[model samples]
Target: MPGASPAALPPAERAAYGRHARTRASRSCHGWFEPAAGRPDPVDVLERQSAARLPELVPIRYGRMLESSFRFYRGAAAIMATDLGSLPHTGLTVQLCGDAHLLNFRLLASPERRLVFDINDFDETHPGPFEWDVKRLAASIVIAGRANGFTPKEQNTAVRACVKAYRRRMRDLAGMRALDVWYALDDADHIRAILSTGTHREEAVRRAGQAAARARTRTHLQAFDKLTRVTAEGRRITPDPPLITPLRDLLTDADAGLRQERQLQSLVEAYARSLSSERRHLLRRYRLVDMARKVVGVGSVGTRCWILLLLGRDEGDPLLLQAKEAQPSVLAPYTDGEQYDNQGRRVVAGQRLMQTAGDIFLGWTRVVGLDGHGRDFYVRQLWDWKGIARPDSMGPDLMALFGRLCGASLARAHARSGDPVAIAAYLGGSDHFDRALAEFAQSYADQNERDFAALTAAGQSGRITAQPM
Candidate 1:
């Protein structure tokens, strides 16, 4: 209750209110899934979103989305939000990972040097219905199950495991002290135990330690070795077109390159203001060496992302930071406007509120682009022992186990900003919510396939462009 806003009603009354909500919007209604009347075309939604992004990179977003139905689902957060908005929800709000796809959860090194599993992406994070996150997470399992060749029964089992884990975890969190729930985190050992077994499990343990060690050791020196080389004039980042291309290569004019360098310098200075005083001082120790435009993630391909390589006391000491563009959350329209004007701050604040351990260098800034338009961006370490459970390679059993792990993690995240007691009461003791969610997952998966096919047809008909096969 330390940071929680005081409620007019007591805890028990709030919980009873949730139970009452079930009568108006029965837990059974969660199972209801059908395309709403006059639903907008998913492709059209995507095309409208593309208009605001970098024109050249839009095709890459479409290209990556074209790979599979699951990938399409990943990139189509806006489309899903439109559908989720039409559904009957409990009206209870929480900080949602608006794009809570399976791949977005990953392992990262905590500030304490321990490896932990958490929701790693927050580009679309915002306060919204708690069920929205759960629904999206459940649908991800169904889509991934299909992509991994799981049978219908196996996929249903995965969905059940996920929803059940969420229910059980919410119930557990509800009984615990509020401070305890805030302090809870999923460590590497616990996550490995839940998701891996035999050689895979043993490998996970080894990898966890290795990942921690690498995070500590993989500073600017390691990055310089991998991404830069000794040049006649100090060290310069090697150019890898499309993926990592230096600004110098993109800007032929010397003055133009200098202007970009100045812009980035100003951006970093503004970003430093968002960090703690200690972190700001720590950041000042490094000097920017090079920067490049980098494309990251299937859904984020079209966004403006840049990597800044910095040098510390000497060439041996280095740091790598990524500046990723942040736009309004897909949930924005449905919910009230955010308190923060800058979307980058919105993303950073939501991330800090939800995750147990957040990036030490996390910060936000706004900058004018080459086109003279302003954009908001958040900055953090590009990588810190980040890894994901590859759903495509996992068997049904392992995938189910991983789904449960993701489910529990998500529950803890929601509890941070939501009423766990209310959520648990709404779920009840039986598997009603689980079965309902499973059915909804199946129905949504079918819709995803249809939407994906629509996009493919648009591409084939030359209405929309896609990457070459």
Candidate 2:
């Protein structure tokens, strides 16, 4: 089968390859996790990342991470990458959500204006062993469960549930036609259906409906109403100090601000080139009115991010876009090296590959000379029916249910880019892999706690500055 592609091979042959993978790394072996004696300091890993980020915002990132162990885990992808790299893997590859914590799975509007549940973040996405993502997600469930004061048994149960869902969903995808697998999407109704099968069916279904309704209200127009103000000159983004500062306020100098504004406009034009012609034409209808530096996400706090306000047709019609900096994935050093010339393009490509549907305005651009240094950025609509889960608000049963949803969603995403047949066969028809991951999740959650304490000590000892938001 030298000339035959993996997808072209018979199902039996694909399953054989999966079974063969167990020789390189056994399924049960994944349960064991002990940090190497010479493991790199987790804080040091974070410091290395901070060197490339804005110095002023680095403290805020630290502050966010110091809030809890789970918060620290969200920002510790690079640390985990090093740990995971130290272990043997099965060599089954997929587009990993390098930071696939439970929170990253959320509700967002698809291109067809339907509220869909899917993986919403891709800053650290790259091709890697499929189990890496499963481990990341499983560990997150344990960590979140701990934060919510769940017993160890409850935490293990949640972790097992998540892994089981991933395994079963991969098996289902394996048996489906390639085109059907590609076309499958987990919409709001589908999520309600899944929730209805759980212990608290009525309550879960009601919450799902509420979440969908809330997401629908989070549109670009809603963002415009909340984040902008009508000034004497025109509509401008309201400044909210460190969290949101318009370019003019940052530059202070009138001449420098004007130059920076012009540069950003040109970058927007460049980003439009990456989109399809139809979307570009639709974009051309709006004119850039304002742009502001914005801080976003627990892990991405210090990176350069901007909110661009564009107005179309009239003052009432507005478009909000976010141009977020794209740094090299935290998984870069551990996995195969860089694959794309522009980091922004790398992010966009991965998102399009894994997501069932994407933002119509999604694109990328590289900026030059604005600050005498070049940087890459990916652009997308600022708001489109977005809703994130609050882990603290969830009980054990609900948390487990959410974990199942995340797991199934993750399996769908990996199936788009990896071999589901091979993965399903590797997982088999038992709970062996699920139990192994549950074990691994507990060990990693313990490691995460140690790392979080190290960060807290760093902050208290004046080794690192932390400014509460």
Per-residue lDDT tens digits for candidate 1, residues 120-146, read 999999898788898899999999999
TM-score, each model? 0.93, 0.98
Task: Give RMSD (Å) of candidate 2 vs. truth.
Answer: 1.3
Candidate 1, residue 248: the lDDT equals 84
lDDT of 2 by residue, 1-469 (tens): 3345678889999999988899999999999999988999988999999999999999999999998899889989989999998898988888888889988999999888888999989999998999999999999999999999999999999899889989999999999999999999999767977797778778777888888888899999999999999999899999998999999889978888888988899889999999999999999999998999999998998999999999999989999999999999988887873499899999999899899879999999998745689999999998899888888888888888888899999999999988899999989998999999999999999999999999999999999999888
Off by over 4 Å in 2: 1-4
lDDT values for all models: 0.85, 0.91
Candidate 2 lowest-lDDT run of ten: 1-10
Which residue segments of model 1 deviate by more than 4 Å?
1-9, 192-224
Highest TM-score against the true fold, candidate:
2
lDDT of 1 at 230: 69
The Cα RMSD in angstroms, rounded to one decimal, for candidate 1 relative to the true structure is: 2.8
